[model samples]
Target: MTAAPGPSRIVRYAMAVAWSSFLSAGVLEALVFAVVDPHELRWFGAAPVELSAEALYTLSFLIFWGVVALGASLALALVNLPADEPKPQRGSPGWPR
Candidate 1:
């Protein structure tokens, strides 16, 4: 049987939550990067030996927010999946009475 079609409140809520989390994380990331030393960013990965603080902050911001946004968007998309519907029996070719 075909599933019923309608707006999904759950999906909307999930998306809202995801975006809110992403925004909050982004703000926090910016604040932390503003004060942390660039040399301390090596934990992220190997890079050129002499990266500047501003460069490190920019890179960190991009990486942090990119991951946050991507992960949240995936979660929200998954939450938006339509509810499952039972299939009709083979002998029943029309809507149930």
Candidate 2:
């Protein structure tokens, strides 16, 4: 018999990473960047930062999006992990084991 259809693995992974990137790089990091402009950034000993706003934003987006994507995919994988052993029915002989 044909099995019921469901989302393919790629579709599930893409959806997760896309949402994760949007929330991380688009929303959360955007809020933080708004409050902490690159021009206002400082280095050790109070030295002015060197990176331009564009470069900083790009770097931050990459880092945040990568982390969120990894986390999302890993979580999805873990959530779908198969059972190590078959579950025993309540009245089955294996149930006591």
Candidate 3:
């Protein structure tokens, strides 16, 4: 029988998903901000509402991509989890002799 995934494997899988999500979200956010309001380029300033129709379209695209990337990464991470292991017999020592 296959061994269950240890804590390290779980953490590694989670990290992979987290990193991918972070990078994809950051890129998408940047693209949306750049297209929506080029003047509001301040990294720490409040967003401005001076966006054109083209800018809105671009922003929508960015959001779509972000959602897709997030979903894909989560799905991949979930798939990497180890399959269920057989439960130990009740009223017995935990490990097999």
Highest lDDT scorer: 2
What ranking emerges by TM-score with the best candidate at the front? 2, 1, 3
Model 3 pairs in collision: none
Local distance difference test scores for all models? 0.68, 0.77, 0.65
Q: After superposition, which runs of candidate 2 have C-alpha atoms over 4 Å from their true positions? A: 1-8, 44-46, 81-97
Q: Any residue pairs clashing in model 1, and if so which?
A: 1-88
> In candidate 1, what are the lDDT values of residues 29-93, reduced to their tens digit?
87886786556655447754477777766676777766776777777767656665765477776
**Model 3 ranges with Cα > 4 A deviation:** 1-7, 38-70, 77-97
Ranking of all predicted structures according to lDDT, beginning with the best and ending with the worst: 2, 1, 3
Candidates 1 and 2, the one with greater TM-score = 2
lDDT of 3 by residue, 1-97 (tens): 7677567655766677667776776677667666655544434576655766567556656676668667976688566556667766667966655
Error of 2 at 46 (Å): 5.0
Worst ten-residue run, lDDT, model 2? 81-90
What does the lDDT read for residue 84 in candidate 1?
Answer: 57
Q: All candidates' TM-scores? A: 0.45, 0.59, 0.39
